[model samples]
Target: MPNKKLTDVEKLAIVQEIEGGHIGINAAVRKFGFSKSTLMKWRNRYRLYGMEGLAIRTCNRSYSAELKLQAVMDYFRGELSQYQIIDKYKISSRTQLADWIKKYNGHSSLRAYNGGKTAMTKGRSTTWQERLDIVLHCLANGQDYSQAADQFKVSYQQVYGWVKKYEAGGPEALRDGRGRKKAPEELTEADQQKLAMRKLEYEVERLRAENVFLKKLQEFQRGRR
Candidate 1:
């Protein structure tokens, strides 16, 4: 696993501090903000392999798509927590594993996740239907604007704006406004009622789908057990 490049003298000092019995390992970790496992790994390497093992190596390493998928599957199978998987696989960062899991669950392509290549980032305009779908999906998943932005590969401001517009005007609010004079922001009482009705319909549909998915997931878990 790649670590921040520390000088040889700094590495030896840290190892000495831990070994000198002047401070507990937990105190050293709290003071340095280093992971316990990381500190232990460094200490062991310094002891067994001398100063060379503690030396910073090249940071560039690549994991194949299949390997990433397998790691995610092992995580979901309840075999180990993310930190444990990191230690087991000698992964550099837990966030890398998390990104893999997110892509797998979202059914997004590896290239899209790694390259941040998405329709929203490719200069393709979104239709009202697409906007509505994104908004509803975010709401259904109980995602805040930031999480929605990451999951949907849109800007945080875009998700925030869409949600505000959706709450005020429902589906009609998402319609393209290009080359058209802006309408008044105020909605009539009847329009407000229609918006509320449409929002309720969206909520009901999302709940129904969630229920079915949960049932199927439970059945699958039972079969696995």
Candidate 2:
């Protein structure tokens, strides 16, 4: 059975039961069908703030930008791990810490990652222009998707997906609403030919660069003789 969301009252009662030694935490979790982590979270909250800490939050709490940056800096500075940050900040999960780090590192955005109404959106949305800009920047800088994501305020997955689409369909492929089952509008014959030509041009350019590198390597080898 799926784990049910426990109310604050229910959580407090369970914690109290365990604290009273009526049942061990492990046994209570087995009997109640709750995970050990869940019980541990409840116990921790209870210990820190009593019943008030277990209160069910109706809305997601928003952290200030400064707080988010501070947490990320702390992690980056090796001052603490995600778990330690959670305890220090009274945060509910390590995932929140990670999201803060991603946003601070320019791999995500405050608007996208903030625990707002639309926070549940799977990934950040990007326009075709932004996609093209990211792709071009990555190519120009010789950056992989991860590096591009960190430099461009986008997810690595997004960068990778956009590059694949651009390769398969050229600039036109970077348009929105990809991966959906609905067929996109038909491209003109000229547009189809243009995409093919663009792809070929990119491949030729890559090959030329590789050829130059190989020639340089051969010269160095010959000079070592």
Q: Write down the lDDT that model 2 would get.
A: 0.67
Stretches > 4 Å off in candidate 2:
1-3, 19-24, 111-225
TM-score of 2: 0.42
lDDT of 2 at 28: 84
lDDT for 54 in candidate 2 is 90
Looking at model 2, which ten-residue stretch has the lowest summed lDDT? 113-122
For every candidate in turn, the CA RMSD to the true structure comes to 11.3, 13.4
Local accuracy of candidate 1 as per-residue lDDT tens digits, 1-225: 345667767877888899788777788788877778777767765665577657776653456544565466568768798767766665555667788778766766544324443322111367766677778767866745545665666654467678788788666678887664335356567866755775687789779978999999999999999
TM-score of each: 0.38, 0.42
Instruction: Give the per-residue lDDT digits (tens) of candidate 2, residues 1-225.
Output: 245777888888889999999999889878888888778778876776678779987766666443554465567658787767777777666667777766556544444236432111123778776787777656644546556666666655567668777777767678866574323347677866755665566567667877888999999999999
- The stretch of ten residues in a row with the least summed lDDT in candidate 1 is 115-124
